[model samples]
Target chain A: MAALAPLSTYALRLGDDALILGQRLSEWCGHAPTIEVDLSLANLALDLIGQATHFLGVAGDADKLAFHRDALDFSNCLLVEQPNGDFAQTMARQFLFSTFQELHLHALASSKDERFAAIAAKAVKEVAYHRQLSSDWVVRLGDGTEESRARMTAGLDWMWRFVDELFQMDELEAKLAKGGAGVDKSELRAEWDRRVDAVLAEATLARPASRRPVLGGRRGHHTEHLGPLLSQMQFLQRAYPGAVW
Target chain B: MQDWPLWEVFIRAKGGLSHRHAGSVHAADAKMALEHARDTYTRRMEGVSLWVIPSAQIISSDPADAGPLFEPAEDKIYRHPTFYSIPDHIKHI
Candidate 1:
């Protein structure tokens, strides 16, 4: 097979996004509002982490890629890795990102590259469930009570800036998309907007006014939040190199 | 912080099968309850179908009445199919 440097990078970027978000969600293991929610978050974390393993395995040595990479070396979008501010904030981030990911992976599932397509086919199913869970939570929180509605609105506003970055395309992605080995993220925007807007309408929440999109996680320029998240996630591997249980 | 109501979950593991009780979850409504039940009980694709009903809506006989409600049947050996002996020649029985 011919070398596909760009596709590998794309896979890593997707893997890192899932990995970072999985780490963030796992933080809610024992801390979620109820035992059922605790299990739900943990289960979703496991699904994302499982996707990370598959994508990272395709990119390189899965464990090394996950544990050795610094924040600067990661290619995850900025939407993930944001701190879990509250349940509402977490759900907002989950809703936005999972919806985007579901669409993204659904498109990727038809890639000309068989391996990539197979991985995406599997991931899209998981992301579908994640989208449903997050969408349901968004509606519940948005329409539940005065305090929940306020918090849900605030959460959406807080995370709104990062939404646009999910659909941004660079030269590599464009080239791969032309070759049928990648998704044209730009094309996904209209449908993403429709789905999100429908959910928001049902939730009785208005979309936040458009703002300048935050960018650069694809280039490894990340928020201050990513550094600390990496510190904890990489702690064990860094502390004891080659250690295994 | 919001203490949602309890819901009992049931899952049909395959087609043409009954949905047996799996477990329960606490959720704000039936939809969230179904989601929670799916996440909690069907992570392994254990079910082809799911049902989540509010625990509050189910009425049950008190366990304290178990002695009167069930003990009378215990002494009735004729209720047991095993009480009838098969003849030695009845091979298919």
Candidate 2:
């Protein structure tokens, strides 16, 4: 196997995260509880897909990288690939992930590597809106009626274990950070915690207890959910290579 | 399952322009109402700004009294700016 550059891997990791989460959000296209909610979700999905395209484009041919990669070769974090359990669950995943992503991109916008910096600069604004959408939902569901509160809590529970993995820095990330091409994830945790905690407080929701961190998605190990997601997402390209609409 | 209140959405296509009624959406609160308005109305870049007012709060004149409300104004040509011609040199009047 040809060894991939650390920077390329980093770009792919972020790209895959956006692509997978966008795919998950796309599942809500026709199924969201309300037409407004459906439009919001779809818009957010489009934003993520746009981000994915830019990130993957920087790494290589965006379409080929997205459609042809095997599941084992993808670098998205496990948190993004988790099934959208319910509205609350989906919101929880989105809130947690977008919060982290926004913070990370803010730091990456100042990266020494101009390419990473440029991409991150553009993505930061889009992720800001995404973060707002998720955060609002989190507050609403958390402070809402008994059923919504319970569902929101359960959703947080479903996602909390994966939170730690987002801040875990492997050698590649550490090297990139040292070279100013990547963010030091550890530095982002405190701010992420502050923003999340404040929102949870306002929503009258308690933070979930910490558990064993589920790691390895950055290293290509993912939950079973990703296989089916990739199959559905990549179907057109796989079935009809080079076909253009 | 609870239905939210309806909000009337207005959009200003550009800066320094009055907001015109665009559409309406249902939301539980003011913030959500604004969000829904943006999601629903601004997808095509139709406006630079938005206003969301609760539909119930707006009092409209009775359409049955249309003649009394507007018919008299229809013939008030003197009130029309177009009644006077501006000098060509007064450009953009």
Candidate 2 has a DockQ of: 0.74
Poorest 10 consecutive residues by lDDT, candidate 2 chain B: B80-89
Q: Candidate 2: misplaced stretches above 4 Å? A: B81-91
| Candidate 1: tens digits of C-alpha lDDT, residues A73-124 | 8889999988899999999999999999999999999999998899999989
B15-86, model 2: which lDDT tens digit per residue?
999999998998999998998898889989999999999999999999999989999998888897786878
TM-score of each: 0.95, 0.96
The whole-model lDDT of each prediction reads 0.92, 0.92
Residue B27, model 1: lDDT of: 86
What DockQ does each candidate score versus the true complex, computed on alpha carbons? 0.78, 0.74
Find the candidate with the highest TM-score and give its number.
2
